[model samples]
Target chain A: MGEFELIRRYFASAACAAGAEGVALGIGDDCALLAPAPGEQLAVSTDTLVAGVHFPEVCDPFLLGQRALAVSASDLAAMGATPLAFTLALTLPTADAAWLEGFARGLNRMAHNCGLALVGGDTTRGPLSMTVTVFGRVPAGQALTRAGAQVGDLLCVGGVVGEAGGALELVLGRQQVAAEIAEPLLARYWSPQPQLAFGQALRGKATAALDVSDGLLADCGHISRASGVALVIESERLPASAALETLLGAERALQQKLGAGDDYVLAFTLPPRHLAELQAQWPQMAVVGRAEAGEGVRVLDARGQDITPRQGGYLHFME
Target chain B: MGEFELIRRYFASAACAAGAEGVALGIGDDCALLAPAPGEQLAVSTDTLVAGVHFPEVCDPFLLGQRALAVSASDLAAMGATPLAFTLALTLPTADAAWLEGFARGLNRMAHNCGLALVGGDTTRGPLSMTVTVFGRVPAGQALTRAGAQVGDLLCVGGVVGEAGGALELVLGRQQVAAEIAEPLLARYWSPQPQLAFGQALRGKATAALDVSDGLLADCGHISRASGVALVIESERLPASAALETLLGAERALQQKLGAGDDYVLAFTLPPRHLAELQAQWPQMAVVGRAEAGEGVRVLDARGQDITPRQGGYLHFME
Candidate 1:
């Protein structure tokens, strides 16, 4: 198909314009034009997912598209920014019309769900890879950072974690699980909903915040190292899904939750005094642990014994 | 090395302060925050260059760094926008410290030259590739568009074309050329100067503008087909450089200039009446052709014979 036809068919849709407030020129132009809000600052992040490296080569393209955008948007969520616009650079080995349609459908579905618009990008010939650069807007002094955790703050995470990594294990044939349990696990692996609303909710209240991309323990360690405060994530308090428990078992689920990656859940640190207020308004959030007065991250079992893994989580390059 | 320390050494040098119209947050964070100018809109574009696809695998990494940023920034110039910042997604086979040093050095040098900051980026392990998403500010309704060219507008280009493609041929060992000529050609391939100033100058003057990326014939064809007007470029007046002529022979240079790609120079259309005014103010610009009442792009010889090539220029997927 011609470039014009491709832009019209796959790239132009209402779903691509959901959160594009400042986008003056969207998909039809040589470049996308966006006017940022007068008082708000823009937040930008880019991530690339390769066919075999980041996702399975034969996985659902729709789910892959959704997860790719979600992972990149999670970075924006981590900074307490509201999602706005994103550009997708799609490189393919060959142009398969059916593949394009399916991929775009998945991307559009997720784009609508997450409230982000597709702006401008390039399509090229290469091995299958998707690079999404997402933009967001946050107020001047309120963006959450990795370097803001206070010594005595409460460490929190939204919703459940470890399901995604556990799901990936099932897909890789490292574990065998029934469809009843496997469905939700696969969904978690494919469709991570970045905690946009919760992150925005924690803009001023959360001292340090980040998305749990590389597992709770590893990502929490990033905050600890950045802020020079010790963090304790209690294994007993960690949330577990029925799917995670079925596939990974209780103990293994806890281990995966502590050491696996691609959860995309929001992990934040708040002052202990604000815990009552946070819980009053948000029931989904749980104070699973606390930030202590030193450095590094610690994981404690039900009886307060150390259960921290020697290697915190996936060291991306090392893996 | 630690992830944070590696980031500090290789990525942090590319960071810049957002200044008085301050950034809510800058580098070393999950994402960077940027405040858009009061009455301005942000123009955004994304492009990815992959090893053994976009460029030769053994080509200089420093040049790859410069060319990658230049090519992506050219999209902003084409839209007549002033660049502000960029985000990079860097994927590599391994964490080659020396390679990263050179790449970052080249990127930092080009960032300084273009007056853009490295806002945020993700570094991961994969096949070597880089995806850079650039942002620029332009006044509402004033940015040049490719669909605005009217019949009879003069087609002009900012600089010489074909040098980059010519350099590629040499790099691929298909052409034997002197180093003196090859050095400049290679430099042109490695580091394309995005004609931002010239593009901005044509904001109100030119009816339509875009960078000659794929090639003059192909890119001008974009304007011609989009605007429903035929663009006729004269062979003699196609802004052939002395260096190019000396290297490729005059006839070969003319052919290369017609179909060569990656010359990140502005190609625009303006009314003939504004020609004198444009030339008086912007002497570097060469009025090489004219847009007509018909469709498609055509080249005119000394006797004004139509000399359009069978193939216009490079198409990413096809090539």
Candidate 2:
């Protein structure tokens, strides 16, 4: 069969490709038409994942599919937008039918979870990689950006961090552990649930927000630079999953929580007045830091001394 | 320097990256915010071009950048949507400053010409490839689609069809010709102008439309299938550029016009009553044939004899 037929069979027939709200037209067209509700602005983000670079070259297609969409959707969550539609540009080395089937199933499952419709995409023959461009809708002036944090706001994280970072060892076959410790970490790495609902809940409350993909200290620096305020992290307050702690012990887990990347948990700045009410609703939410009247990011140990790492997190293409 | 700095220097500082009318927030954010006109629907399309598969691996980066954006922007033209903003997910083998500089210049030039702002995108290290997701806006219910052709509507193409196809020989260094004959053909291959204005003019007039990427015959088959009608093409009506004819001669040029792809020209079905007026506005618009009450696509000779090829255009993965 032709690639066109392959795409139609694997993707066009997926459940999320069916007509959905906000999508006036979906697949099988030159362009997909989306009508955002009146007074809402469209939120758009694009992310590309390459084999070996972003994920294991030889890995489960189903997991790869899930991780790809989740990583892109996390951006919309950071913006406090309602998920609407997405386009996937997939490049594969070959047309492996079994792999495509598994991938599509996982992709559709995540699409359902994220409330995103598969509006359009292009499939081509090349290196194994995919670019997912996600679209969402937010009220005209209510999108949560990294540029709104104030000096006196408390810096917080929505969920556990560093589990995905610890899972990388098992994914690369460099380490092995019992399934009890491994499963949760791997699941966090593969199927991270973008904190969509919590981000929406933060629209009027959070001063600034972003999904953590580049470690706690590094991502907090983005908020600092964008909002023109400094961020101070209390190292003892960093949240690390039990799976991560079990896999790497407390000291290494603390290091991962501070410097490892790829955790999709949201990190945001919130005024002190709104903290109590929000914490009541979101129990996992932890206050780890605070914004300061300065520039750059700093980390503090329990002894009240600065312990910031010289280099915070991973930087792609840094020689 | 880091990848983030590379992106900021090469892309975020481009002329098109500055604040634009429709874009509320651009680069440096998790997601860009775009506000369309109140009654407009967003037209979104994504296209990926892999190195060596889509273009010569050692070709000019500047031309590659121009071709990539033009290829994606053509879909918006096909839908008669006004160009607004685009995100480019570019994966490169390395951060080659010289190549990136040239590529950015070319990309910025096309973005300016097409009136598209540089929105949010991700730059990563991987095999050389790029996926461009473009967003445009058109009045609700007025965007042209492939599902609206009537039985008697005339089949039309906006511009010259075959120069890019003929240029493939030169691109691959398989053919040698005079500079005069080669320049225009190569230009078409590297930077085929999308018929944006012509497509906008066709709004409310053309019944169905799409850009010619897959060969004319194959793309027409799409409209035929979608609209549930047969498209009959008069063989002699296929538009071949003078340069293409000069390079490949009449018969070969005709073949290229019918069977070769990557034209980026607008193909649409229009009622006869609107043809004269549209043709007057768009001098290059040519009426090639008519839709019939049937299925599939056919090509007929001037003698009215059925002469359709057994296979139409290129299909990506057909062994």
Candidate 3:
């Protein structure tokens, strides 16, 4: 079989999903067809991961595949859209069957978790890279956007932060940590669990929502700017991971928590009235701060004093 | 502003288009939203072009940008879907403001021409590469796929072929063509004009359709296998560009037309009764062959004898 036919044979079953109601057609076509339900809109996002840049050059292909899909699906989660389908454009330096099998295994695992079906894509020969564009369906006018935060809205995060960045330091050999601690951190970095369910649940509850990929501080700025309000983020309530705190000290963990990227956790705003109910439903959700009537983002210490850092998150091409 | 913000600024206005009616959101969010009209389904496709592989390491960024969108948009055309939105995932070695400006200019030109809005994407640091995922809308059950060809169906092409491959040979310095012949061939390679209008017109009338990216013979095989039939292609009916013939002669041009790839034209099958009307409307369209009962593909010359090449088009990771 030709390269295209080989891909079709291998990925046809890989694209099958129990939750693929939105996919009218999958794989082996010029374009895959998707039918959104009545009064629903399609939400789409694209993310590319390159070798030696998004991850280590010689890292496990399985992890790379999982991480690629997770990052793209996180955008769908942030938008409160029901997972539907995704297209993967993979560039390989060589056609290694073993590598492809491992990658497909990881991709299938993540697809199963996210309820996303692989619909269309092409595999080409180039420097190793993978670009996944995920699609989801959301009711018209109900998509969680960055422009909905209001004054007095409560700021919350789905989970802890800085674990990925701390793990990245260890993987890059810039830091040392015991294997016991490093294992979970690296897993968090390599295979993040996107808050798809929490995001879907927050649809009617969240005033604004976004996945914290570019650190809490920077991503919070997105909500602030888009909503034309200011975010008051409390450092004490930043929800730093225990692994990060143990690897780096508490003070350094705070720095990483506020400045690192690739968290893929949901950060959203809820009304004061809905806070208790949501918190009761999701015990791990952390109330980090509140939205105020202002512009930009303000970082507050435990004493409620301004202590914003100079840099917020990792900016590609610039950093 | 950071890289993402910079991209937003550079491409926001560029994304504006006449055919953006289906795009509910264009860029700047976690995911761009698209709401197709009721009774319409979305057609999605993804294609990636890598530097030194898809193109030279240092070609004009403007052409690279144009080619990227054109190639992807062609898939939408093949599905008979109206242009809607596209997401770009660009990876570059470094951030060059001038290069970005030129690239955006070219991208904007094609977006306007194709009526495709740039809904979303992100840029990362890596070897130069671009992945564009295009979305379009087609009425339910009206999409022309490769699995609909039948016996006696006339195989046709929307335009001439092999111009791009011949141009590729020139660009790679494997063949030398004079400026008069070289310019048009190179233009075909660098900036293919997708047959969007023709494709849309063929929607309900054609039995099966696909954009000819992998040359006529190879792409013809796709329709044959998918439809569980056979195709009899007349070599004499193959559309060869005047520039290609002038540069490589009749025999060599036929080889290039039959075996070379990168021609973003449309190859499709239609009933014999509808042939005259379509041919009258599109003067460039060529009735090249016929679908028959059997399997695989058979090539015939003017004398109606089998002379199929041992190979078809370029296969990535192999050639």
Query: Judged by lDDT, which candidate is best?
Result: 2
Using Cα atoms, each model's DockQ against the true complex is: 0.62, 0.82, 0.75
Instruction: Report the CAPRI category for model 1.
Output: medium
By lDDT, is 2 or 3 better?
2
Judge the docking of candidate 3 as incorrect, acceptable, medium or high: medium
| Chain A superposition TM-score, candidate 3 | 0.96
Candidate 2, after superposition: displacement of residue B11 in Å?
Answer: 2.0
The estimated TM-scores of all candidates read: 0.94, 0.98, 0.97
Candidate 3: residue pairs that collide: B27-B119
Query: With candidate 1 superimposed using the best TM-score fit, by how many Å does residue A314's alpha carbon deviate from the native?
Result: 1.5
Error of 3 at A73 (Å): 0.7
Q: Which 10-residue span in candidate 2 chain A carries the lowest summed lDDT?
A: A11-20
The DockQ of predicted model 1 stands at: 0.62
| Candidate 1, A112-196: lDDT as tens digits | 8878888777787777888998888887678898989988788898878888989889777787878899988888888898888
Ranking by TM-score: 2, 3, 1
lDDT of 1 by residue, B82-137 (tens): 88888888878888878888888888888888877887777776778888988888
| lDDT (tens digit, per residue) of candidate 2 on B1-319 | 6655677788754434335887888877889999998999999999999988989899898898889899989999999999999998889998898999989888888887888888878889899999999999999999999999999999999988978989999999999999999998899899878778887898999999999988899999999998999999998887757899888888888888888888899999999999889888788889999999999999998899998988867878777
